[model samples]
Target: MSIGNTFYQHKDIHKKTWRHPDGRVSNEIDYVCIAKRWRSSLLDVKVHRGADVGSDHHLLIAKFRLRLKRLPPTPQRARPFDVMKLKQPTVATQFQLELRNRFQAPADCEEAEDQWTQFRTTLTKSAEAVVGR
Candidate 1:
Protein backbone atom coordinates (compact mmCIF):
# COMPACT_ATOMS: atom_id res chain seq x y z
CA MET A 1 0.00 0.00 0.00
CA SER A 2 3.06 2.27 0.14
CA ILE A 3 3.89 2.04 -3.58
CA GLY A 4 3.63 4.88 -6.11
CA ASN A 5 0.34 5.63 -7.94
CA THR A 6 -0.74 2.04 -7.23
CA PHE A 7 -1.91 2.91 -3.75
CA TYR A 8 -5.60 2.39 -2.86
CA GLN A 9 -7.44 5.68 -2.42
CA HIS A 10 -10.96 4.76 -3.43
CA LYS A 11 -14.05 4.76 -1.14
CA ASP A 12 -14.40 2.23 1.73
CA ILE A 13 -16.61 -0.06 -0.37
CA HIS A 14 -13.98 -0.26 -3.14
CA LYS A 15 -11.04 -0.53 -0.74
CA LYS A 16 -12.15 -3.41 1.45
CA THR A 17 -10.99 -6.71 -0.02
CA TRP A 18 -11.76 -9.11 2.87
CA ARG A 19 -14.24 -9.49 5.70
CA HIS A 20 -14.17 -11.32 9.05
CA PRO A 21 -16.40 -14.33 9.76
CA ASP A 22 -18.20 -12.39 12.53
CA GLY A 23 -19.50 -9.97 9.83
CA ARG A 24 -18.13 -6.97 11.67
CA VAL A 25 -14.49 -6.57 10.54
CA SER A 26 -13.27 -5.80 7.02
CA ASN A 27 -9.77 -5.25 5.63
CA GLU A 28 -7.98 -4.57 2.34
CA ILE A 29 -5.76 -7.65 2.45
CA ASP A 30 -5.97 -8.56 -1.22
CA TYR A 31 -4.38 -6.65 -4.07
CA VAL A 32 -3.22 -6.93 -7.71
CA CYS A 33 0.12 -5.22 -7.70
CA ILE A 34 2.06 -4.72 -10.93
CA ALA A 35 5.73 -4.03 -11.58
CA LYS A 36 6.78 -0.40 -12.00
CA ARG A 37 7.87 -1.04 -15.60
CA TRP A 38 4.40 -2.30 -16.65
CA ARG A 39 2.37 0.01 -14.42
CA SER A 40 0.90 1.74 -17.48
CA SER A 41 -0.46 -1.57 -18.76
CA LEU A 42 -2.63 -1.89 -15.65
CA LEU A 43 -5.80 -0.09 -16.67
CA ASP A 44 -7.89 -0.58 -13.56
CA VAL A 45 -8.08 -2.65 -10.36
CA LYS A 46 -11.02 -3.00 -8.01
CA VAL A 47 -13.01 -5.40 -5.82
CA HIS A 48 -16.32 -6.87 -6.95
CA ARG A 49 -18.47 -7.00 -3.83
CA GLY A 50 -21.60 -8.16 -5.62
CA ALA A 51 -19.99 -11.31 -7.11
CA ASP A 52 -20.99 -14.10 -4.69
CA VAL A 53 -18.32 -16.75 -4.14
CA GLY A 54 -19.63 -18.02 -0.74
CA SER A 55 -16.49 -16.66 0.93
CA ASP A 56 -15.67 -13.81 3.27
CA HIS A 57 -13.15 -12.39 0.77
CA HIS A 58 -14.45 -10.25 -2.08
CA LEU A 59 -13.23 -10.99 -5.62
CA LEU A 60 -10.46 -8.73 -6.85
CA ILE A 61 -10.33 -7.98 -10.56
CA ALA A 62 -7.64 -6.25 -12.59
CA LYS A 63 -8.01 -5.03 -16.15
CA PHE A 64 -5.08 -4.62 -18.51
CA ARG A 65 -4.68 -2.66 -21.76
CA LEU A 66 -2.48 -5.28 -23.43
CA ARG A 67 -3.25 -6.96 -26.74
CA LEU A 68 -1.85 -10.46 -27.36
CA LYS A 69 -0.41 -11.14 -30.79
CA ARG A 70 -2.21 -13.81 -32.76
CA LEU A 71 -0.24 -16.85 -33.80
CA PRO A 72 -0.47 -18.52 -37.26
CA PRO A 73 -2.82 -21.47 -37.55
CA THR A 74 -1.13 -24.84 -37.06
CA PRO A 75 -1.51 -27.63 -39.62
CA GLN A 76 -3.47 -30.64 -38.35
CA ARG A 77 -2.44 -34.19 -39.30
CA ALA A 78 -4.69 -37.23 -39.45
CA ARG A 79 -4.36 -39.52 -36.41
CA PRO A 80 -4.48 -43.33 -36.45
CA PHE A 81 -7.52 -45.13 -35.04
CA ASP A 82 -7.41 -47.02 -31.74
CA VAL A 83 -6.73 -50.69 -32.50
CA MET A 84 -7.68 -51.94 -28.99
CA LYS A 85 -11.31 -52.13 -30.17
CA LEU A 86 -10.26 -55.24 -32.11
CA LYS A 87 -10.85 -57.09 -28.81
CA GLN A 88 -14.61 -56.90 -29.60
CA PRO A 89 -15.80 -60.09 -31.37
CA THR A 90 -17.42 -58.31 -34.36
CA VAL A 91 -14.53 -55.89 -34.79
CA ALA A 92 -11.99 -58.70 -34.42
CA THR A 93 -13.72 -60.77 -37.07
CA GLN A 94 -13.76 -57.85 -39.52
CA PHE A 95 -10.14 -56.94 -38.79
CA GLN A 96 -9.02 -60.56 -39.24
CA LEU A 97 -10.86 -60.82 -42.56
CA GLU A 98 -9.34 -57.59 -43.81
CA LEU A 99 -5.85 -58.69 -42.75
CA ARG A 100 -6.27 -62.16 -44.23
CA ASN A 101 -7.41 -60.75 -47.57
CA ARG A 102 -4.44 -58.34 -47.85
CA PHE A 103 -1.68 -60.15 -45.95
CA GLN A 104 1.19 -61.73 -47.98
CA ALA A 105 3.32 -63.48 -45.34
CA PRO A 106 7.06 -63.14 -45.79
CA ALA A 107 8.80 -66.22 -47.27
CA ASP A 108 10.11 -68.82 -44.80
CA CYS A 109 13.76 -67.80 -45.47
CA GLU A 110 13.08 -64.04 -45.11
CA GLU A 111 14.88 -61.98 -42.41
CA ALA A 112 13.05 -61.63 -39.05
CA GLU A 113 13.04 -57.78 -39.35
CA ASP A 114 11.41 -58.01 -42.83
CA GLN A 115 8.74 -60.38 -41.49
CA TRP A 116 8.03 -57.98 -38.55
CA THR A 117 7.74 -54.99 -40.91
CA GLN A 118 5.29 -56.82 -43.14
CA PHE A 119 3.26 -57.94 -40.14
CA ARG A 120 3.08 -54.38 -38.80
CA THR A 121 2.04 -52.96 -42.20
CA THR A 122 -0.65 -55.63 -42.62
CA LEU A 123 -2.01 -55.03 -39.11
CA THR A 124 -2.07 -51.24 -39.66
CA LYS A 125 -3.93 -51.54 -42.98
CA SER A 126 -6.43 -53.98 -41.44
CA ALA A 127 -7.10 -51.65 -38.53
CA GLU A 128 -7.56 -48.71 -40.93
CA ALA A 129 -10.12 -50.67 -42.94
CA VAL A 130 -12.05 -51.94 -39.91
CA VAL A 131 -11.81 -48.93 -37.58
CA GLY A 132 -11.16 -45.98 -39.96
CA ARG A 133 -8.29 -43.45 -39.76
Candidate 2:
Protein backbone atom coordinates (compact mmCIF):
# COMPACT_ATOMS: atom_id res chain seq x y z
CA MET A 1 0.00 0.00 0.00
CA SER A 2 1.03 3.64 -0.57
CA ILE A 3 -0.12 7.00 0.64
CA GLY A 4 -1.68 9.08 -2.17
CA ASN A 5 -1.23 12.44 -0.35
CA THR A 6 2.47 12.69 -1.15
CA PHE A 7 2.00 11.72 -4.80
CA TYR A 8 0.37 15.03 -5.80
CA GLN A 9 1.42 18.65 -5.27
CA HIS A 10 -1.15 21.21 -4.16
CA LYS A 11 -1.63 24.43 -2.20
CA ASP A 12 -1.36 24.36 1.63
CA ILE A 13 -5.12 24.85 2.06
CA HIS A 14 -5.85 22.00 -0.35
CA LYS A 15 -3.36 19.72 1.37
CA LYS A 16 -4.78 20.29 4.85
CA THR A 17 -7.50 17.65 5.21
CA TRP A 18 -8.18 18.19 8.89
CA ARG A 19 -8.36 21.10 11.41
CA HIS A 20 -8.19 21.44 15.19
CA PRO A 21 -11.23 22.52 17.19
CA ASP A 22 -9.42 25.71 18.30
CA GLY A 23 -9.44 26.93 14.63
CA ARG A 24 -5.80 28.01 15.05
CA VAL A 25 -4.21 24.71 14.00
CA SER A 26 -4.72 22.46 10.94
CA ASN A 27 -3.02 19.37 9.54
CA GLU A 28 -3.24 16.72 6.82
CA ILE A 29 -4.70 14.01 9.01
CA ASP A 30 -6.87 12.36 6.37
CA TYR A 31 -5.26 10.07 3.83
CA VAL A 32 -5.95 8.27 0.57
CA CYS A 33 -4.13 5.01 0.18
CA ILE A 34 -3.88 2.70 -2.85
CA ALA A 35 -2.00 -0.39 -3.99
CA LYS A 36 1.66 0.10 -4.93
CA ARG A 37 1.31 -1.76 -8.21
CA TRP A 38 -1.43 0.64 -9.47
CA ARG A 39 0.40 3.81 -8.39
CA SER A 40 0.76 4.99 -11.96
CA SER A 41 -3.04 4.82 -12.42
CA LEU A 42 -3.52 7.39 -9.62
CA LEU A 43 -3.85 10.67 -11.47
CA ASP A 44 -4.38 13.10 -8.56
CA VAL A 45 -5.36 13.28 -4.85
CA LYS A 46 -6.58 16.46 -3.14
CA VAL A 47 -8.92 17.89 -0.54
CA HIS A 48 -12.34 19.27 -1.47
CA ARG A 49 -13.12 22.12 0.96
CA GLY A 50 -16.44 23.00 -0.71
CA ALA A 51 -18.03 19.77 0.53
CA ASP A 52 -20.28 20.30 3.59
CA VAL A 53 -19.60 17.08 5.45
CA GLY A 54 -20.00 18.78 8.89
CA SER A 55 -16.85 17.08 10.11
CA ASP A 56 -13.41 18.21 11.26
CA HIS A 57 -11.89 16.42 8.24
CA HIS A 58 -12.37 17.70 4.68
CA LEU A 59 -13.29 15.55 1.68
CA LEU A 60 -10.43 13.67 0.04
CA ILE A 61 -10.72 13.03 -3.67
CA ALA A 62 -8.61 10.61 -5.68
CA LYS A 63 -8.65 10.24 -9.44
CA PHE A 64 -7.63 7.14 -11.32
CA ARG A 65 -7.53 5.82 -14.91
CA LEU A 66 -8.02 2.13 -15.58
CA ARG A 67 -7.88 0.19 -18.84
CA LEU A 68 -9.94 -3.00 -19.15
CA LYS A 69 -8.53 -6.02 -20.93
CA ARG A 70 -9.99 -6.97 -24.31
CA LEU A 71 -11.28 -10.50 -24.88
CA PRO A 72 -10.20 -12.75 -27.80
CA PRO A 73 -12.89 -13.45 -30.39
CA THR A 74 -14.09 -17.03 -30.85
CA PRO A 75 -13.72 -18.65 -34.28
CA GLN A 76 -16.98 -19.33 -36.17
CA ARG A 77 -17.57 -22.89 -37.47
CA ALA A 78 -18.97 -23.21 -41.03
CA ARG A 79 -21.57 -25.95 -41.66
CA PRO A 80 -20.96 -28.22 -44.66
CA PHE A 81 -23.69 -28.67 -47.29
CA ASP A 82 -24.53 -32.01 -48.97
CA VAL A 83 -22.58 -31.62 -52.23
CA MET A 84 -22.88 -35.39 -53.03
CA LYS A 85 -26.43 -34.80 -54.30
CA LEU A 86 -25.00 -32.81 -57.22
CA LYS A 87 -23.67 -36.11 -58.67
CA GLN A 88 -27.24 -37.01 -59.74
CA PRO A 89 -28.25 -35.68 -63.17
CA THR A 90 -31.64 -34.36 -62.01
CA VAL A 91 -30.20 -32.59 -58.95
CA ALA A 92 -27.42 -31.03 -61.04
CA THR A 93 -29.86 -29.76 -63.66
CA GLN A 94 -32.23 -28.37 -61.02
CA PHE A 95 -29.36 -26.63 -59.15
CA GLN A 96 -28.11 -25.03 -62.40
CA LEU A 97 -31.64 -23.89 -63.29
CA GLU A 98 -32.17 -22.42 -59.82
CA LEU A 99 -28.89 -20.49 -60.02
CA ARG A 100 -29.75 -19.15 -63.49
CA ASN A 101 -33.22 -17.98 -62.43
CA ARG A 102 -32.28 -16.47 -59.03
CA PHE A 103 -28.91 -14.89 -59.83
CA GLN A 104 -28.96 -11.17 -60.74
CA ALA A 105 -26.19 -8.57 -61.17
CA PRO A 106 -26.15 -5.51 -58.91
CA ALA A 107 -27.89 -2.47 -60.39
CA ASP A 108 -25.08 -0.09 -59.33
CA CYS A 109 -21.51 -0.31 -58.10
CA GLU A 110 -21.32 -1.86 -54.62
CA GLU A 111 -18.70 -2.88 -52.04
CA ALA A 112 -16.88 -6.19 -52.47
CA GLU A 113 -18.17 -7.46 -49.10
CA ASP A 114 -21.80 -6.67 -50.03
CA GLN A 115 -21.44 -8.43 -53.38
CA TRP A 116 -19.81 -11.48 -51.74
CA THR A 117 -22.57 -11.63 -49.07
CA GLN A 118 -25.30 -11.49 -51.72
CA PHE A 119 -23.63 -14.18 -53.82
CA ARG A 120 -23.09 -16.44 -50.81
CA THR A 121 -26.75 -16.09 -49.72
CA THR A 122 -28.03 -16.93 -53.20
CA LEU A 123 -25.76 -20.01 -53.46
CA THR A 124 -26.71 -21.29 -50.03
CA LYS A 125 -30.47 -20.91 -50.66
CA SER A 126 -30.25 -22.52 -54.07
CA ALA A 127 -28.14 -25.41 -52.79
CA GLU A 128 -30.53 -26.09 -49.88
CA ALA A 129 -33.51 -26.15 -52.27
CA VAL A 130 -32.04 -28.16 -55.18
CA VAL A 131 -29.59 -30.31 -53.18
CA GLY A 132 -29.61 -30.78 -49.36
CA ARG A 133 -27.98 -29.31 -46.29
Candidate 3:
Protein backbone atom coordinates (compact mmCIF):
# COMPACT_ATOMS: atom_id res chain seq x y z
CA MET A 1 0.00 0.00 0.00
CA SER A 2 1.46 3.18 -1.32
CA ILE A 3 -0.05 6.23 0.49
CA GLY A 4 0.10 8.23 -2.81
CA ASN A 5 2.64 10.76 -1.36
CA THR A 6 6.14 10.90 0.08
CA PHE A 7 5.30 9.64 3.63
CA TYR A 8 8.88 8.69 4.51
CA GLN A 9 10.21 12.29 4.83
CA HIS A 10 7.58 13.14 7.50
CA LYS A 11 8.57 12.84 11.23
CA ASP A 12 7.59 9.68 13.22
CA ILE A 13 5.01 11.68 15.31
CA HIS A 14 3.17 12.85 12.15
CA LYS A 15 3.62 9.51 10.37
CA LYS A 16 1.85 7.38 13.00
CA THR A 17 -1.81 8.54 12.81
CA TRP A 18 -3.70 6.03 15.04
CA ARG A 19 -2.74 5.30 18.67
CA HIS A 20 -3.95 2.25 20.58
CA PRO A 21 -5.73 2.62 23.97
CA ASP A 22 -2.69 1.07 25.72
CA GLY A 23 -0.39 3.58 23.82
CA ARG A 24 1.80 0.63 22.69
CA VAL A 25 0.65 0.14 19.09
CA SER A 26 0.52 3.15 16.72
CA ASN A 27 0.18 2.92 12.96
CA GLU A 28 -0.55 5.08 9.91
CA ILE A 29 -3.89 3.62 8.74
CA ASP A 30 -5.52 6.71 7.20
CA TYR A 31 -4.46 7.84 3.73
CA VAL A 32 -5.35 10.19 0.87
CA CYS A 33 -5.74 8.37 -2.46
CA ILE A 34 -5.87 9.93 -5.93
CA ALA A 35 -5.58 8.53 -9.46
CA LYS A 36 -2.05 8.59 -10.99
CA ARG A 37 -3.39 10.79 -13.82
CA TRP A 38 -4.20 13.51 -11.18
CA ARG A 39 -0.88 12.98 -9.35
CA SER A 40 0.50 16.24 -10.84
CA SER A 41 -2.47 18.20 -9.33
CA LEU A 42 -1.75 16.86 -5.82
CA LEU A 43 0.66 19.34 -4.21
CA ASP A 44 1.17 18.11 -0.63
CA VAL A 45 -0.40 15.84 2.00
CA LYS A 46 0.27 15.85 5.78
CA VAL A 47 -1.13 14.68 9.12
CA HIS A 48 -1.93 17.31 11.75
CA ARG A 49 -0.86 15.73 15.08
CA GLY A 50 -1.82 18.81 17.19
CA ALA A 51 -5.57 18.50 16.43
CA ASP A 52 -7.55 16.98 19.40
CA VAL A 53 -10.78 15.58 17.90
CA GLY A 54 -11.21 12.95 20.74
CA SER A 55 -10.38 10.22 18.21
CA ASP A 56 -7.51 7.75 17.83
CA HIS A 57 -6.86 8.91 14.22
CA HIS A 58 -5.13 12.24 13.50
CA LEU A 59 -6.46 14.80 10.96
CA LEU A 60 -5.01 14.41 7.47
CA ILE A 61 -5.06 17.31 5.00
CA ALA A 62 -4.14 17.30 1.32
CA LYS A 63 -3.46 20.33 -0.92
CA PHE A 64 -4.37 20.21 -4.59
CA ARG A 65 -3.89 22.61 -7.53
CA LEU A 66 -6.59 21.79 -10.06
CA ARG A 67 -8.11 23.49 -13.10
CA LEU A 68 -11.74 22.54 -13.87
CA LYS A 69 -13.10 22.92 -17.40
CA ARG A 70 -16.21 25.09 -17.70
CA LEU A 71 -19.21 23.65 -19.58
CA PRO A 72 -21.24 25.73 -22.10
CA PRO A 73 -24.63 26.92 -20.90
CA THR A 74 -27.68 25.14 -22.39
CA PRO A 75 -30.13 27.11 -24.53
CA GLN A 76 -33.46 27.85 -22.73
CA ARG A 77 -36.57 26.97 -24.78
CA ALA A 78 -40.15 28.30 -24.39
CA ARG A 79 -42.15 26.24 -21.81
CA PRO A 80 -45.46 24.62 -22.70
CA PHE A 81 -48.75 25.51 -20.90
CA ASP A 82 -50.07 23.50 -17.92
CA VAL A 83 -52.30 20.66 -19.19
CA MET A 84 -54.33 20.58 -15.87
CA LYS A 85 -55.64 24.15 -16.55
CA LEU A 86 -57.52 22.77 -19.60
CA LYS A 87 -59.74 20.71 -17.21
CA GLN A 88 -61.47 23.91 -15.99
CA PRO A 89 -64.71 24.70 -17.90
CA THR A 90 -64.06 28.46 -18.49
CA VAL A 91 -60.37 27.95 -19.38
CA ALA A 92 -61.20 25.02 -21.70
CA THR A 93 -63.86 27.05 -23.63
CA GLN A 94 -61.55 30.10 -23.88
CA PHE A 95 -58.61 27.99 -25.06
CA GLN A 96 -60.74 26.23 -27.75
CA LEU A 97 -62.12 29.58 -29.09
CA GLU A 98 -58.65 31.27 -29.17
CA LEU A 99 -57.01 28.23 -30.87
CA ARG A 100 -59.80 27.98 -33.49
CA ASN A 101 -59.56 31.72 -34.36
CA ARG A 102 -55.76 32.03 -34.34
CA PHE A 103 -54.70 28.75 -36.00
CA GLN A 104 -55.39 28.79 -39.78
CA ALA A 105 -55.19 25.31 -41.40
CA PRO A 106 -51.92 25.17 -43.41
CA ALA A 107 -52.20 24.79 -47.25
CA ASP A 108 -51.37 21.42 -49.00
CA CYS A 109 -48.18 22.92 -50.58
CA GLU A 110 -46.93 24.16 -47.13
CA GLU A 111 -44.13 22.17 -45.42
CA ALA A 112 -44.98 20.02 -42.38
CA GLU A 113 -42.18 21.67 -40.28
CA ASP A 114 -43.51 25.21 -41.08
CA GLN A 115 -47.09 24.14 -40.21
CA TRP A 116 -45.85 22.66 -36.86
CA THR A 117 -43.98 25.88 -36.01
CA GLN A 118 -47.05 28.04 -36.77
CA PHE A 119 -49.26 25.74 -34.65
CA ARG A 120 -46.82 25.88 -31.72
CA THR A 121 -46.57 29.72 -31.87
CA THR A 122 -50.36 30.18 -32.02
CA LEU A 123 -50.98 27.74 -29.12
CA THR A 124 -48.30 29.36 -26.90
CA LYS A 125 -49.65 32.87 -27.60
CA SER A 126 -53.26 31.86 -26.79
CA ALA A 127 -52.18 30.01 -23.61
CA GLU A 128 -50.16 33.08 -22.45
CA ALA A 129 -53.22 35.38 -22.91
CA VAL A 130 -55.40 33.17 -20.64
CA VAL A 131 -53.12 31.00 -18.42
CA GLY A 132 -50.30 33.64 -18.31
CA ARG A 133 -46.68 33.39 -19.56
Candidate 4:
Protein backbone atom coordinates (compact mmCIF):
# COMPACT_ATOMS: atom_id res chain seq x y z
CA MET A 1 0.00 0.00 0.00
CA SER A 2 2.95 2.29 0.63
CA ILE A 3 3.95 2.10 -3.01
CA GLY A 4 1.86 5.03 -4.32
CA ASN A 5 1.86 8.17 -2.16
CA THR A 6 1.56 5.73 0.68
CA PHE A 7 3.72 7.92 2.88
CA TYR A 8 2.68 11.14 4.63
CA GLN A 9 4.66 14.34 5.11
CA HIS A 10 4.81 15.72 8.63
CA LYS A 11 5.81 19.39 8.96
CA ASP A 12 4.86 19.36 12.59
CA ILE A 13 4.07 15.82 13.51
CA HIS A 14 3.62 16.57 17.18
CA LYS A 15 1.03 19.29 16.69
CA LYS A 16 -0.70 20.92 13.73
CA THR A 17 -1.45 24.62 14.14
CA TRP A 18 -3.97 26.07 11.72
CA ARG A 19 -6.36 29.00 11.90
CA HIS A 20 -10.01 28.02 12.20
CA PRO A 21 -12.59 29.68 9.94
CA ASP A 22 -14.25 31.13 13.06
CA GLY A 23 -13.08 34.42 14.52
CA ARG A 24 -11.28 32.50 17.23
CA VAL A 25 -8.14 30.76 15.79
CA SER A 26 -7.80 27.02 16.33
CA ASN A 27 -5.73 24.10 15.00
CA GLU A 28 -6.79 22.50 11.74
CA ILE A 29 -6.20 19.01 10.29
CA ASP A 30 -8.15 16.54 8.21
CA TYR A 31 -9.22 14.35 11.09
CA VAL A 32 -12.38 14.56 13.18
CA CYS A 33 -12.71 16.00 16.68
CA ILE A 34 -11.61 12.79 18.37
CA ALA A 35 -8.10 13.34 17.00
CA LYS A 36 -7.48 15.64 19.92
CA ARG A 37 -6.85 12.53 21.98
CA TRP A 38 -4.13 11.41 19.54
CA ARG A 39 -2.60 14.82 18.74
CA SER A 40 -0.28 14.68 21.70
CA SER A 41 1.70 11.79 20.20
CA LEU A 42 2.16 13.44 16.81
CA LEU A 43 5.88 13.54 15.98
CA ASP A 44 5.72 14.99 12.50
CA VAL A 45 3.08 16.43 10.19
CA LYS A 46 3.55 17.93 6.75
CA VAL A 47 1.39 19.44 4.06
CA HIS A 48 2.02 18.45 0.46
CA ARG A 49 0.15 20.65 -2.00
CA GLY A 50 0.17 19.83 -5.72
CA ALA A 51 -1.52 17.25 -7.87
CA ASP A 52 -0.29 13.78 -6.92
CA VAL A 53 -0.85 12.58 -10.47
CA GLY A 54 -4.71 12.64 -10.49
CA SER A 55 -5.82 13.18 -6.94
CA ASP A 56 -7.61 16.52 -6.36
CA HIS A 57 -6.83 17.26 -2.70
CA HIS A 58 -3.26 17.81 -1.61
CA LEU A 59 -1.79 14.91 0.38
CA LEU A 60 -0.77 15.23 4.00
CA ILE A 61 1.48 12.87 5.88
CA ALA A 62 1.65 12.37 9.62
CA LYS A 63 3.86 10.18 11.69
CA PHE A 64 3.36 9.30 15.31
CA ARG A 65 3.63 6.39 17.72
CA LEU A 66 1.21 5.35 20.42
CA ARG A 67 2.30 5.01 24.01
CA LEU A 68 0.50 1.85 24.95
CA LYS A 69 0.57 0.31 28.41
CA ARG A 70 2.33 -3.03 28.80
CA LEU A 71 0.40 -5.85 27.25
CA PRO A 72 0.57 -9.67 27.71
CA PRO A 73 1.53 -12.02 24.91
CA THR A 74 -0.66 -14.36 22.94
CA PRO A 75 0.21 -17.87 21.82
CA GLN A 76 -1.23 -20.13 19.17
CA ARG A 77 -0.67 -23.60 17.70
CA ALA A 78 -0.80 -25.15 14.23
CA ARG A 79 -3.61 -27.62 14.76
CA PRO A 80 -5.63 -29.33 17.45
CA PHE A 81 -5.66 -33.02 16.48
CA ASP A 82 -8.28 -34.08 13.94
CA VAL A 83 -6.47 -32.85 10.81
CA MET A 84 -3.53 -35.08 11.73
CA LYS A 85 -5.73 -38.15 11.23
CA LEU A 86 -6.55 -37.10 7.67
CA LYS A 87 -2.91 -37.13 6.64
CA GLN A 88 -1.25 -40.43 5.80
CA PRO A 89 0.77 -42.25 8.45
CA THR A 90 4.27 -40.97 7.77
CA VAL A 91 4.45 -38.79 4.67
CA ALA A 92 7.41 -40.88 3.57
CA THR A 93 5.77 -44.16 4.54
CA GLN A 94 2.50 -43.27 2.88
CA PHE A 95 4.39 -42.05 -0.14
CA GLN A 96 5.74 -45.54 -0.57
CA LEU A 97 2.37 -47.19 -0.05
CA GLU A 98 0.47 -44.94 -2.40
CA LEU A 99 3.16 -45.18 -5.00
CA ARG A 100 3.03 -48.94 -4.82
CA ASN A 101 -0.77 -48.94 -4.87
CA ARG A 102 -0.94 -46.77 -7.95
CA PHE A 103 2.17 -48.07 -9.68
CA GLN A 104 3.40 -44.46 -9.68
CA ALA A 105 6.95 -43.54 -10.61
CA PRO A 106 9.32 -42.42 -7.86
CA ALA A 107 9.45 -38.96 -9.36
CA ASP A 108 5.66 -38.70 -9.14
CA CYS A 109 5.76 -39.76 -5.50
CA GLU A 110 8.38 -37.14 -4.78
CA GLU A 111 6.14 -34.50 -6.30
CA ALA A 112 3.25 -35.63 -4.12
CA GLU A 113 5.50 -35.47 -1.06
CA ASP A 114 6.42 -31.92 -1.90
CA GLN A 115 2.74 -31.00 -2.16
CA TRP A 116 1.98 -32.55 1.22
CA THR A 117 4.77 -30.53 2.81
CA GLN A 118 3.15 -27.34 1.58
CA PHE A 119 -0.22 -28.47 2.88
CA ARG A 120 1.28 -29.26 6.26
CA THR A 121 2.75 -25.79 6.65
CA THR A 122 -0.47 -24.03 5.64
CA LEU A 123 -2.66 -26.24 7.81
CA THR A 124 -0.47 -25.79 10.87
CA LYS A 125 -0.49 -22.01 10.65
CA SER A 126 -4.24 -21.87 10.08
CA ALA A 127 -5.25 -23.90 13.13
CA GLU A 128 -2.96 -22.49 15.80
CA ALA A 129 -4.37 -19.38 17.49
CA VAL A 130 -3.57 -19.49 21.18
CA VAL A 131 -3.84 -16.63 23.67
CA GLY A 132 -3.20 -16.23 27.36
CA ARG A 133 -3.36 -19.61 29.13
lDDT (Cα, tens digit) per residue for candidate 2, span 1-133: 9988976779999899888889989999888888898888899998998999899989999999986679898897766888998999998999999998888895563888888888889898898888876
lDDT of 3 by residue, 4-30 (tens): 545447777766778898999998888
Q: Which stretch of 10 consecutive residues in model 4 shows the poorest summed lDDT? A: 1-10
Model 2: residues with Cα > 4 Å off, grouped in runs: 76-133
Indicate the worst ten consecutive residues by lDDT in candidate 3. Answer: 1-10
| Highest-scoring model, lDDT | 2
For 6-121, candidate 4 gives per-residue lDDT tens digits of 13353442233343446364343444222556655666555455425453333555567889779687776533445453354565454445434544234543587776765565
In the range 67-90, model 1's lDDT, one tens digit per residue, is 567999999986968767877999
TM-score of each: 0.43, 0.55, 0.50, 0.27
lDDT against the true structure, per candidate, is 0.78, 0.87, 0.79, 0.45
Which residue pairs of candidate 3 clash? none
Model 1: weakest 10-residue lDDT segment is: 1-10
- Which residue pairs collide, candidate 2? none
Error of 2 at 46 (Å): 0.7
Top candidate by TM-score: 2
Candidate numbers sorted by lDDT from highest down: 2, 3, 1, 4
Q: Name the candidate, 1 or 3, with the larger TM-score value.
A: 3
